[model samples]
Target: MIETAAREQRSAEPVVRPVRPRKLGKVPFVELADGRLQGVVSSGSDLARVYVSSISAATHGFSCSTNNNRPCGGLSGGSPCKHLRALADEAVLQYGLDRVTRYLRVEAGDDDDLMSRLDGTREAAPAAGVFSRFLRHLAYLELPGSTAPIAEMHWFPAVSAEVR
Candidate 1:
């Protein structure tokens, strides 16, 4: 694992790489962490609700539910719900297709669709963990912009200090 201090001590020069960005409307939050591709996906039916969906990296086990713990009706045994698919697609955008492919241990040719290649089963997993993480991330966005170091972030490296 990369340590915050170690990362902070690196060279000041910016390292350039191919950039990829995604619209936040569909799947606002996506991540490849905790051994799964998980995120909060907007609900198509209800404007007030968002679904938390996840696909396991090992077995591609799937689950989707509202933040309120209501299961998504679309998650049948044969396939993952649209929210899960959206989450995976957004993950690929956030983390390159190659990274995601390697993380999930999926083998696919360049021309193949990512989801179509996955053979997954409907797994009854809890949504609380994923949803709570999403909420915590949102909380950071609400914090007032400040250069002052936060006490809670003592371990975080201030790489921005190197810019100027």
Candidate 2:
């Protein structure tokens, strides 16, 4: 009877183990045109755009708002978030700025005026407005959904205990 009771008690006890959060993987490097290793870049002129895109892609997804301020999980509310850093790092590794600039010039097309508008070297123009809207749409596609609503819908941080 005593042995049976002890066994039952031991079986009822819960086991506990340490838990660790998963780590984000490192970004890969791309080769550049200058015989120097760098990350992938569409063009030198597009470097700023690319940097913004990558960072926004990495951190803008599923953000929460508290007190009217948005906080991104991957970035923790930092400007020029990790995604931007990774993109820049990759770009430096893949191509020097010179190559990137040439690429941008080639890609910008006959609309030299549009390029200048984006570069902010000229007065605000109608084309700039259209381009801005297009970029906003792209950003929307990259980061979808409101994290605040999701958080309000769920209860998190489950309780755990250990028995010895």
> What's the TM-score of each model vs. the native?
0.77, 0.23
Which candidate comes out best when scored by TM-score?
1
Top-lDDT structure, candidate number: 1
State the local distance difference test value for candidate 2: 0.32
Candidate 1 versus the native: TM-score?
Answer: 0.77
What RMSD value applies to candidate 1? 6.1
Residue ranges of candidate 2 with Cα displaced over 4 Å: 1-25, 29-78, 102-164
Q: Report the number of backbone clashes for model 1.
A: 0
Model 1 stretches with alpha carbons more than 4 Å out: 1-19, 149-164
Q: Put down candidate 1 lDDT per residue, 87-138, tens digits, no spaces.
A: 8788887777887899899986667778888898888776899989988999
Worst 10 residues of 2 by lDDT: 55-64
- Report the lDDT tens digits of candidate 2 across residue range 1-164: 33445545663333322222222134322322222122322223433332112211111221111111223234454333444345444443344343443533323333332122222111111223223443555587688677566553333323342222
